[model samples]
Target chain A: MSTARANRMTPYLFLAPAGIVLAVALFYPICYMIYASFLDWNPSQRIGEADFIGLRNYTKLFSDAAFRESMWVTIKFSMVVVTIEMILGVGLALLLDRNIRGMSVLRTLFILPMMIAPIVVGLMWRYMYHPTVGIFNRTLTDWGFDPIPWLADGDWAFASVVIADVWQWTPFIFILSLAALQSLPASAIEASKIDGATGWQQIIYIKLPLMLPVLIVTLLLRLIDSFKVLEVILVMTNGGPGLSTEILSLRINRTASEFRELGEAAAMSNLLLIVLLILTFTMFIYNKAQDARMARLRKVEEEV
Target chain B: MSDKTYDRQNPAFYALLIALVVMAIGPIYLMLATSLKLNVDIMSDSSSLLFMPTLRNYETALCDFLWYEPEHLRRCDPTFGRALVNSLVIGLVSTAITLVIGTMAAYALVRFRFMGRDVVSLWTLMMRMVPPAVLLVPVFGIWTFQFGIDGSRGGIVLVYVALNLPFVIWILQSFIVQVPIQLEEAARMDGAGPFQVFFLVVLPLIKPGIAAASIFTFRVAWNEFLLANALADRNSRTVPVTIVNSLTEFDIDWGVIMATGMLLAIPPIIFTFVASRQIITGMTAGAVKG
Candidate 1:
């Protein structure tokens, strides 16, 4: 009788530990964040002591030009970084999706950037971007060209941050695109070849069409991740020379730590979360729609 | 044309490949070279290539762990070494705990039909969207005020486990879905209990998933800076926190900091080399789900 009961309870038993941990650690903190967003809180004050000032944090953020600039910067950074990385990554994927020797070695090397800590990645780039004793400036000097202000100026600082991110993340998209290309239906390409299709034409038509689903998914994932990028930019520019390079995450960090306004940071976090949630929902809907389209196509083909 | 034989490409193509390889690893190579060089050599305007490479910077970073006192070091700062230990402990312990419970939860989600599974799955998806910066405030508040676990390695571990759980469970779900339900049935028929079936049957089959999940979990715990910085006091600081702290100083020690950065980068690079296939599979499976 006890054994029967245990068997019935097994799944719940397996799940209970994770459930408890997630509730205490993950779920509760998020609920705390939502509540904290409404309160005039500080790091020095306990939650019980913090006054509840509903919606002021959100309204103030909208009025704050600095916050607005950071928001725009975040959006611009995500869009520009994702666009450049996608083009470069996917283009390279197409160019090198061949039975070449050392492909495995190349991939292993490519993943190194993505694998390493973002703080360390930022440090390396910061070192390279240093005006004196830095590799880039040193090289420029060696070539008898004036050393460019990589991180000292506003526009250059933003561009430097973007370059570092592109260097680190492009391989991620490349590897994924290559995987999608490899797993593509060989027969579709073979048929295209039999019709005397040029390499570019085959890629433009069948290959691109087949890889579209993965590409879309990859693009959305990268876009979502680009918003979360904090450390690399933090290390590279620290949002310096002005507010030009201050993305939302960096601004939130400053608000909470430097400014000592936990409520404002929480409000900023809430907005960022909402933006991410919208993007995530878009991906989910896209996936659902694609599923429906695939099902409909299968049904149509069956009737034919 | 043969599938088995490597495809031959143009000379120009090989040149392009070499250039791409060089470009991809260029910054990393620069880091490694800088780490091995002295400050004098690094600051030199003369040819950067030919220089006496020394491990003095590495020695400085790992001074606390050295068996004999390093003579070059006037005095040793124990921060980096302590942080290295903290990072390892937090990363490994959190990863182990996460994998155990996360894999079990994933197994239940895949193999058993239950009311709670939907809730669990929903939390996993939602949690992935929340960034670390977003958590910095609430987690700091909760840990410091509510739980009072701040300034301990355990606090950082808890956050990491929670932070990593969603991805781990999600990745493991796909792998668990592929596990043959028949194997569990056969084991059940042989009088293996539910716990035994999971541990003896299902878990072993999902080794690849475990490998991938563990790598990711450990990587996050190891590499994370923001929350760890906020939560950790001086005693519990991780390597990233230390690296960032050092960077904020007015006069930067390029060679030493680069050496520290190189040390922080070594484990992930090692993982990539050892299990590139698993890491790639995990990346695609977790993201593309196809």
Candidate 2:
């Protein structure tokens, strides 16, 4: 081959391994799951032996109350966690966006929660939320107050999982928001300040608007992630306090393992997959829009 | 007086910020404090902020047979030491593999104008968007069936690489694009082979990018739980898996779990502290600029 031809082929050569892996490991599994979702699959039955139900599983799931509850729990959980995390995260980023000694250390410390293994985080928070011995109740007792049921009560169990999730993942938003904040054009904010805009006013009118794109992407990313969350809640509550904390992933786990309804679980996963697909599609479209906008701006600059 | 005036002007803002920070980090602080307290102390004053602190929890966690059955002589509790080692091995090895393979792919994507380039890039991006849950059942089936690689560290490592490859490729590709191709062209003109040019010229040029990618991969693998739980049996259990298994509501040991959490958080926390600036800059350079 000519040198140019060889050079052009080099990328394809390098990309082969990853391509094969993705094709086999990713696409194949997804196809298998999709195929399996069509079957009356039980744990014992092989794919070949299983009767192909042809959307029966999906149809069954629509009327399943437990599955519906799980979906509701997932939606509620994602909404609550993402909303609170965004608020706290953006709020924290705004607060910490300043030059000071040890600020980097403080910022690193702030994001520490996101670094620990989710299972470890779940275990850690579980310990801290222990009814009789956890630090929350311990501290409350020290203050001469009655210890509230943290994990036993259904509502509290849901809130407990949300708290642990927010604790671990809010840092994701914090770092992204902080980066967005730092990247905002300084002069715009400086001009706003000079125009008698208060800090809050500047943040509202200038900073937030500038950071909106990053925030939206980050929000979508977090939402997508929160939808798939399983390990922490599994480790912490095991979807306990009578299914109060059972998010979709947990429900899928239990359905497959505990209920031994592999087909049902697969169907539920397909539902979750659809929800995520919508979110992912929205994000993809949003990203394309932003990229197109940037390309237009670049073209304008080139013309200038 | 000027300082006082400034303080007065920013009072509520500063207060709100401080309160938010405290709220954000409150549970972690509580975990740390609880990790240092004795079980008796922890249990006795479940609501008490004022406890005589002790290192007994850490001591018991690290030294004592908290989960030992005396008659059986089998340590039923998962050892934090073993889990740590497993995590480090899996994280480091997978990260190294990812770096090598991902960099090569990224370099190709950035430099080569070839057929299916857009499709390749799109494939890589879509890999990242594939949620772990979607793959778990299928992967579990595949690993258990095809390879008989059930619950092995190697199996988990392979899955981690698959999970992390797209991210590494995307990030490294951006960095590789920032590297000028003219240098490689010059190296080629000097009769350097592709391998020589890559290793001697381009590799050193993207060391920081590689470092950032490597560290990010390491963090992801280290913090990963789902695949580890799915793939690794007790013999190859990672820190996260061990910690999860430790949480037994019927006969819970809060202190040991807290101690394990503290231990699990240490590596990544230390990593963040050591490379905070590099991480911040590297992450933004790839993410924000794109």
Candidate 3:
């Protein structure tokens, strides 16, 4: 009886440290940020000392053109980056799904770009995009072509950042979808092949339908991560050429540090957090629905 | 499309594979090559590959840590060396703390059906998507004013531990689920207490999960800049923070900066090469599993 009683407390015991840390460091700070959003806070004033101007910071955000622009940039960046990465990544995964030699080596090499620090990634790209000494410009000059203003002009800066992100993240989608593809019920693919389905027909009809679930999850994950990308863009452009590449995260960082408006920054953060939370909640709901559907199908099959 | 085992592909396919590999590794190779070159060679409008490789850049970045003073060094900046130490300490300590607490929590969630278990799992799932950038403002405020631990390695470690716990717990849960419950029961039957059973039986089975969790936790801590930047004082700065700080100069030291970026990037790259399988397993744990 005593042993069982002691065992009853084990779960709490195991959970306490993580619970404490998350509460104090993660959960509390998030709450603090939400409260701070309503106040006219600054770097100098403590949270308690600041005047709580109920939702003024939030109201101010809507009128702020820069904030709107930056938010738009964030959305645009995520959509473009995810779409391009998905196309290239899934395409590469599909094309390279064969029983090839040195596949591990190929994967290991592909993981390099994703594995390296985003700061370093930005640096590599910045060097390559450098006008005088960068490899791209050098090659362009060698071929007697005009050098593009990679990070100088606004439009080009956005494209440059997108290219860097694609280089870094395409392999991630490739690897994930590759795992999904390889794990795909071989019997199903074999049946499709035996049914005289051509490559295109097999991919369009059978393989894609099966891969949709994993692809949606991958897309959502990538979309959420693209919002988190700041350091790479920071190192590359520093949101230069007049806020052209200033995504929401970078804007928040700038607002707090450069502008010294902590409350407004917190409000921006709260908005970004809400967007992410919605995405996460969607993913959670989707996963639950997927499981429930699978169970229902299994039950029906059992009855049959 | 047939499942002809290890079927030979056309030469163009192999060529495409080679091209992809080159494209993937190209920028990394350029960074490495730049880190090894002098500023003069880097700036020179000449053949890029003809320059003599040197460790001058690395020497400059790691000057304070070297046994002997580099003769070529004029003023040794202790910033990179100091930040390197801070990064390593923060990365390792945070990884250790996050892994221990995270694994225990994961084990409990997996083995025991307790109240609020669903809440905890959902919380973990949500927190995994919380970006460090999103945490920047409040973490800075609380650390500085409320917590009073700002500008210290401890503060940085605290945030990192908090940031990584959710994902670590989530990943380890999947791993711990695969552990045979019968083994734990046997251990318990041998008069082993719950703690003993967890430590002796369950812990050993989840080595791959631990490896994956540690790599990811350490990577975030080491590579993190925005929070670390806001929290760290001059002396407590990590490599990423220092590298970003160095980028604001009008005349940038391309060689040394590249070398510093390379240093900051080395651990994750090494982890990738060493444990690619575990890393992949960790990354695809959720989306692919779903």
Q: What is the TM-score, restricted to chain A, for candidate 3?
A: 0.98
Instruction: Choose the strongest candidate by DockQ.
Output: 3
Evaluation by TM-score, superior candidate among 1 and 2: 1
RMSD to truth, every model: 1.5, 4.1, 1.5
Worst 10 residues of 1 chain B by lDDT: B115-124
Model 3 - which docking category? high
Residue B62 lDDT (model 1):
97
Residue-wise C-alpha lDDT for candidate 3, range A1-304, written one tens digit per residue: 9988989899999989999999999999899889989999899988889998998999999999999999999999999999999999999999999898788889999999988888899899998999889999999998999998999999999999999999999999999999999888999999988989999998889888999899999999999899999989999999987889999999999999999999999999999999999998888889889989989999999999
Question: What's the interface RMS deviation of candidate 3?
Answer: 0.8
User: Per DockQ, what order, best first?
Assistant: 3, 1, 2
Q: Kindly provide the TM-score of model 3 when superposed on the true structure, using C-alpha atoms.
A: 0.98
Q: Rate the local accuracy (lDDT) of all candidates.
A: 0.91, 0.77, 0.92
Question: Residue B87, candidate 3: how far off, in angstroms?
Answer: 0.4
Cα TM-score per model: 0.98, 0.89, 0.98
Residue B192 lDDT in candidate 1: 97
What fraction of the reference interface contacts is present in each model, in order? 0.74, 0.46, 0.84
Per-residue CA lDDT of model 3 for B175-269, tens digit only, reads 99999999988888889999999998999889999999999999888888899999999889999888888889888899999899888778898
Model 1 quality (TM-score): 0.98
Worst lDDT run of 10 residues, candidate 2 chain B, spans B1-10
- TM-score of decoy 2: 0.89
